[model samples]
Target chain A: MELYDLELSGNCYKVRLLAALAGIDLTLKPVDFLAGDHKRSPVIDLNPWGELPVLVDGGTVLRDSQAILVYLASAYAGHAWWPDAPAAQGDVMQWLSVASNEIHYGPNSARLVDKFGYDLDKATTLQISERILGLIDQHLQSNEWLAMGRPTIAECAVYPYIAVAGEGGIDLTPYQNINQWMARIKALPGYISMPGVA
Target chain B: MELYDLELSGNCYKVRLLAALAGIDLTLKPVDFLAGDHKRSPVIDLNPWGELPVLVDGGTVLRDSQAILVYLASAYAGHAWWPDAPAAQGDVMQWLSVASNEIHYGPNSARLVDKFGYDLDKATTLQISERILGLIDQHLQSNEWLAMGRPTIAECAVYPYIAVAGEGGIDLTPYQNINQWMARIKALPGYISMPGVA
Candidate 1:
């Protein structure tokens, strides 16, 4: 498998982290994002959305971090990372939606603004981050994992942005449950670390 | 199964439309979204995110439209709407991410701003809509469905927002392929229509 990766992107890191945790060997093909390579041919040909973390496995080419996580979990890790049952799948999927929507627009956008100088409202992004982080903290109060009783793709989908939220000027100090949840994810076997995360 | 729904919400409508097409009987529980019903007890208690289209099926209370679609498709619709294979699931899931992210922020947010008096940048939302719609049109040029050869949850996830993009000041007349794609979805057996769509 070949993973088109950008080291600084949380979305790309998600695929890397999941592959590492699952012990799946993936040849890293780094993209020159700053040089606008992703928006051009090859990358654009693979994913019209011009997004990073495009996975080319045999005959299948997939994009989107959440989708890649689903592909990896289903194809490699078995039910341990992603359940097969309908209810369990739905339960896990809700968090993937949250990751794609709230987490992406919240901490991810905020990070883009602060770390990369992207033109987005920092105040709004921070507010979004706070709102989603609060909800996640509340959700984690009773449950150890985001979905199901065990670690699922939900964790892999949501962990990166929340873990590196400080770079986006969003404080994690107030979210104790979220902090513990991040700790738990780090403790998972074969866990890999990204730049912003400790 | 009971679906907590708001008729005007594209997200909620996605579930209802899918259920109708799948021939699954769903008891609709209307939520007075304008009256802050979704943010109050019952709704808020079921989904802390306070989003609409919550599905209560026996032992499972599922939130998020994409997640609910997954539940319905996996539990009832067989492999027609959502396939069982890993690569196929990934292909379908990529569009679900697009619905949750691009469609939500693009056409959905623009609609919210126009019809519901949401405080958001209309220009940005329309720009997002244009970019995604263009990509969808390009993708649809060669393929009839968003993913695979048949209509999957990808179509269900993306259809509502694009169908009603005009309400958000996004002109859809330019995208012939998207128009044809929408027509194809409407032609599907047991397909249901929502307000603002022909």
Candidate 2:
């Protein structure tokens, strides 16, 4: 299997982290994102979205970090990472949606503005970050993991952005529950750390 | 089962449509979105995100339209709407992420700006809408369905926003392929239509 990756992208990092945790060997093909390599041929051919973190396994090519997480969990990590029950899967799927929507627009967008010079509304991104972080903290007040009471793809999906939120000017100090959750994720077996996370 | 829904929301509509097609009984509990019902107690208690299309089934309460779609398909739709195979499920999930991210921020955001007076960048939303719609059209040129070559959750996830893109000031006339895809979805057995789709 091969993964088209960008070192700085949390989305790409999540895929790498999950693959490592699952004991899956993935040949990391680094893309020149700054040079617009992802927007051109080969990468664009692999994923029409022209997004990084495209996973190619044999004949199957998958895009989107959340989707890739689902594929990895289902194919490699087994039920421990992603459950088989409908409701249990839904529990994880809810956070995946949050990862794609709230997390992407919130901390991810804020990071893009601060670290990558993307023209986006920082105030709105910060507001979204605060709201989602607060909600996750509250949810984590009683629960250990995001869903299924175990380390599912939900944790992997939402982990990177919240862990590296400080780079986006969204402080994580106020979110104590979230802080502990991040710690628990880091303590997981075979955990791999990204540049901004630790 | 009960669905907390707002009739006009494409997200909510997708859940209802899926249930209708799957022969699952859903008692629609209409939330007064204009009255800020979704932002308040019961709705917020059900889903911290406070978004509509919350599904309550016996002991399980699920939020996010995409997540609810997964739950419904897994529990009731018999793998027709959402397959169990890893690659196929991932294929469907890729579009679900698109539905949540690109579709939400693109045509959906544009609709919010035009139809509900949301303060958003109209130009960016239009650009995103055109890009995603064009990509979908190209992908559909060779394949009948978005994924798995059948009516999967991928179609259900993306159907609403593109079908109602005109409400967002995004004209769908140029994309003949997308128009045919929309028509194909409408022609599906047991398919249901929401407002502005026809």
Candidate 3:
């Protein structure tokens, strides 16, 4: 299997992180997102939306980070990351939605815009970040992971952007549980830090 | 099983529609979003994010429309709406994410701000709607369902918002394939219409 990826990108980093965790050896093919390479034909064939972190595994092309994580977990992992129980599954999935829909697109995107020196709606970004971080902090208080009682898909997908959310100008000091959770994630064996960060 | 939902809400409607199709009978409890009732105690217990379409199967309170759909399909269905094939499953999940993050949060939210007389960042909403609608239309032209050659989780979760996106102030008439897709989805037996429509 080959993963079309960009190293600096947190979204691309998600697939790479998951692959490493699940012991899925993937042929990594870097895509030049900055040069409008993802918008071209063959790349578009893999991702019609022409986005990064596209996974190609013989007769299959998959885009979107959360989707890729789900596939990898469902296909390869040994029953630890994805909790198959009914309510527990729902709980894990809810956080994944928050990661992809609320947090990542909110503070993560805002921070990216800041890092890249692009204009962002500052007020909205701050509001989104503050609220999302608050909800996460609240969740982390009673639970070891994003999902209660288990480190499921929720933690796998959401923890990274949250750990780096401070880079987007949102302070994480107030969220003690989140800080602790971040440390726990880093301690996992085979954990690789995202590219370009010391 | 009971579903806490609102009649006119696209997210809430998704839960109802899928349950009906999947042959699961849910006791419907209407949650009044207009009254700010969702933020209150028990409702908050249902979903900390305070969103609509919370499904309670006895003790299990499932939030996030897509998450609820996954639970329903995985738990109750005799057959698969969420295909087991990893690659196709990824594709199914990708569009479901698109429905929540982009389609509902973008165009659907934009249209609601219009109806509720809430302030909106118009330029951003327009940009988001155009991108989402164009992609959905193109996908529809080539694939009969958003699931891509199968009626998977993606279709059950996403079809409602896209079908009514024009009500969100998107001109769906321009996307001929989307128009056709709407007719097909509507033609499905047990199909239900969202509020403010015939």
Query: Evaluated with DockQ, which candidate comes out highest?
Result: 1
| Cα misplacement distance, residue A167 of candidate 3 (Å) | 2.6
Cα lDDT for residue A48, candidate 2: 88
Q: Rank candidates, TM-score, best first.
A: 1, 2, 3
Residue ranges of candidate 2 with Cα displaced over 4 Å: none
Writing each residue's lDDT as its tens digit, candidate 2 over B160-180 gives 988889999888999888888
lDDT per residue (tens digit) for residues B1-198 in model 1: 899999999998899888888898999999998899999999999999998989999989999999999999999989999998899999999999999999999999999899889999898898889899999999999999999899888888999998888788888999999999999999999999889774
Lowest lDDT 10-residue stretch of candidate 3 chain B = B78-87
- Model 1 CA deviation exceeding 4 Å by range: none
Candidate 1, DockQ to 2 decimals? 0.91
Scored against the true structure, residue A42 in model 3 reaches a CA lDDT of 74
User: Model 2: per-residue lDDT, tens digit, A1-198?
Assistant: 999999999999889888878888899999999999999989999998889899999999999998898898899977888898999999999999999999999999999999999998899899889889989999999999999998888888899988888889988989999989998999889999888875
What DockQ class does candidate 2 belong to?
Answer: high
TM-score, candidate 3, is: 0.95
The superposed Cα distance between candidate 3 and the true structure at residue B1, in angstroms, equals 1.1
Better of 1 and 2 by DockQ: 1
lDDT of 1 by residue, A45-157 (tens): 99888989899999999989999999999999878888889999999999999999999999999999999999998888988888999999999999999999788889999
